[model samples]
Target: MRRSREGYEIYPVADAIGGISPTAHDNAMQRMIQAGAQPVNAISLVAELQRDWGRARADELRSILRWYFPKLQEIRAQN
Candidate 1:
């Protein structure tokens, strides 16, 4: 995955979900294949599936919050 200033771009996934037709996501997947951007597995980046937020994801979330929510500041040391 490539990282830009905005954040980790979900590219194809966003395109896949941002579909109008029933098979729009499938078409996005096809486009990803055509562009050689096939994914091997899905990993949780934050919240939800990750449950109580893993250590790595916690740091990432802290960074994100810091960038967007300046008032929050430090998110405390990892447990």
Candidate 2:
């Protein structure tokens, strides 16, 4: 059981896990690798990469955004 800042009772974010599964490593890596594949997803991915992973990763994220931004602009120009 937990209480919030105002002292109201609150449910936990999730129940405690007995133990982490070994495959969790591979699953997390796969999610990271595939996150840049979509437009909306790329936005968050760039933010996360910049804030947490620093300049090198941020530059890579910028390149990904630049690659996709032109396509989006073309789509906007069509309408």
Candidate 3:
């Protein structure tokens, strides 16, 4: 939240972050949103960073996705 207020584009990974309690987590998320943070899931963040499939780092990105998120790869294969 402070980072957002300082003009940084904050991208908080929703699933990757946690708090002591569910209510605390929800409140923190709300505060971050109010302070200009953009919440995103892991897959969405990766997709945003790898916008172009034909980019030079495409293979590397895909490899990372495969390693860190095998289910994502499975879903892609099914599609």
Candidate 4:
């Protein structure tokens, strides 16, 4: 993940999920594929499974405020 001064600072999904290393994420994704999980990236999985701001979206809108504002107070610490 690159850290830009004016753009989004990308983070590894595995890191967000369970602090798993890159190698681990790769292995996990591979295992998931073998297990028939559509071969999605870790980031996508996090965005799908993580319920942020009381409004979890099919997309990665956890960073979007307007749609997730309702659960801000409760999830701020987690954020």
Candidate 5:
């Protein structure tokens, strides 16, 4: 497995979104979609959206994070 600078193991984040149990994956997708439905015209809103998804899917959160990173990154870059 690849390792991050902080020494965390780095399996492909995308893998989490793909092969997870279907019920978990679908739940994550729905949360991600909801998080993404908000206006991203401001950084606070983007942060809130990210936090919302992270909290909503805390048990298996990375799937949503994987699905929405690009959009979230774009919003973060604006801050």
Candidate 6:
């Protein structure tokens, strides 16, 4: 929320963050949204950051995804 106040675009990974209780988590998520933070999951965050597959850093991004998200790589391979 401080970042959002500072005019930074905050993208909180919805699935990766949580509070002690379900109610707390929901409230925190709501607060973030109210503060102008965009909630995204891991996959959506990656896709947003790597919008251009044919960019110069495509290979580097692929390497990162392969290392951190092996399941995604596997799915891509299967397709």
- The C-alpha TM-scores of every prediction are 0.33, 0.34, 0.59, 0.31, 0.24, 0.57
Query: For residues 1-79, what per-residue lDDT tens digits would candidate 6 score against the true structure?
Result: 4465567888889878889998999999998898878889987888888899999989997887678777766868999
For lDDT, candidate 1 versus 6, the one ahead is 6
Assess each prediction's global lDDT (C-alpha) against the native: 0.51, 0.51, 0.84, 0.52, 0.51, 0.84
Structure candidate 4, residue pairs in collision: none
lDDT of 2 at 44: 56
Which lDDT tens digits does candidate 5 get at residues 1-79? 3344576643222323443587886666555445442222333444455676547555465555566778777988999
Question: Candidate 1: where is the Cα deviation over 4 Å?
Answer: 1-11, 14-16, 40-79
1-79 per-residue lDDT for model 1 (tens digits): 5444566544443421546775886787777666555443323223344566556667776676457444323433322
- TM accuracy, model 3: 0.59
lDDT of 2 by residue, 1-79 (tens): 3344576553211112122664774464445335432222445545654786455556676677788889778989998
Full ranking by TM-score: 3, 6, 2, 1, 4, 5
Candidate 4 worst ten-residue window by lDDT: 10-19
lDDT of 2 at 63: 79
Query: What local lDDT does model 3 show for residue 39?
Result: 92
Query: Model 3, which residues run further than 4 Å from truth?
Result: 1-3, 55-60, 63-79
TM-score, candidate 2, is: 0.34
Q: What's model 2's lDDT at 66? A: 83
Candidate 1 Cα deviation (angstroms), residue 54: 6.1
**Cα misplacement distance, residue 60 of candidate 1 (Å):** 10
